[model samples]
Target: MSEAFTKSMARNIFFGGSLFFFLVFVGLTIHTTRELPERDHRENINEMVVLGKKVWEDNNCIGCHTLLGEGAYFAPELGNVYTRFGNSKEAIKGFIMSRPVNGIPGRRSMPQFNLTEEELEGIAEFLKWTSEVNTANWPPNIQG
Candidate 1:
């Protein structure tokens, strides 16, 4: 015997699917919460990192640079930049500080933000913090 298609059947199917998806969502949330501490490294976040984040957001740095595989691809991935720069924050600072305001001729270049010394330190520290995040090997290259 073939089952008849009815409103009740439709309603039951909808409710069942909803319940199943809800449970799946809850399970995923729990799993993510459990995994966060191991991955987040929230304990290391400091005032310097906070200021660095502010500087980044204020200047729209993400518009040109990618961090941890996020943001625009116009420039380079800064996720592993600390490691890429020979574990030196000073190198990162120097690169940022040395950018010419008008950019190089015949080539795309980073704009000079004219950041102050404090802001530079803050950004450097922030980059250091970002490099510490567990990205599971992103950027696919040491240079970026």
Candidate 2:
């Protein structure tokens, strides 16, 4: 506590701290880059998956439902929906096709999008592809 404060000591401390953090940043960047290919399933992308994503965006499905815990929570979480629906693409398609256009009385219900058969299949394929991604157990529930 009796030591005098010096500019040289202060400059050294600042440089040391900056260098430590810079190295940590670089290390984390490298680690993330190396891990992305393993975590993201780019191999699963196809024409149907792309079309399905386009349909999802066109309808603004995220405005009501959450996907991978990112969207609004007004509806059920769809991050794990493929698994929740018993891993059946037909089941997903059926649910979308069965939505009531007028909605139920005094209850929240998904609106019918009047999707074509091709669009329905595309959406199902997209959901299936999304389910194959490595989320490390996101949602953490079977019912979501």
Candidate 3:
């Protein structure tokens, strides 16, 4: 009931707040760990998908486009690109293959990567896998 602030009271408040927040952090980490496997659908990963991921990294695709909201904003979000491409791997491949070798005049354009058939297939499979992940309605729209 005393109006004067005391050192013991300040210490208790600081320790109490820290403990509460620490517990909350631990709880959140546990929850994320439990949910990640189900949401990520890791069981779907295959050889092709692995190869595709390697190609993506080698090509620095993230440098231009985003995957799952991570990467540069210069290009489009490719996390759901498989779905956006009408759920057809061929369409995805076609789009990539169709890009002009030289960019458009005074406009942004995706450059042709000259990927082989196998690489194209791998990338398509990887994109398909990403599309199937349970992102909890990420991108908030179909455009992504």
Highest-scoring model, lDDT: 3
lDDT of 1 by residue, 13-69 (tens): 999999999999999999988988888698999999999999999999999888987
Model 1 clash pairs?
A: none
The C-alpha stretches of model 3 lying farther than 4 A from their native spots are 101-106
**How many backbone clashes can be found in candidate 2?**
0
Clashes of each: 0, 0, 0
Shift in Å, residue 74, candidate 1: 1.7
Q: After superposition, how far is residue 88 of candidate 3 from its true place, in Å?
A: 1.0
Candidate 1 whole-model C-alpha lDDT, 0 to 1:
0.88
Judging by TM-score, tell me the better candidate of 1 and 3.
Answer: 3
lDDT of 3 by residue, 104-123 (tens): 57877888899999999999
TM-scores for every candidate against the unseen true structure: 0.81, 0.88, 0.93
Weakest lDDT window of 10 consecutive positions for candidate 3: 100-109
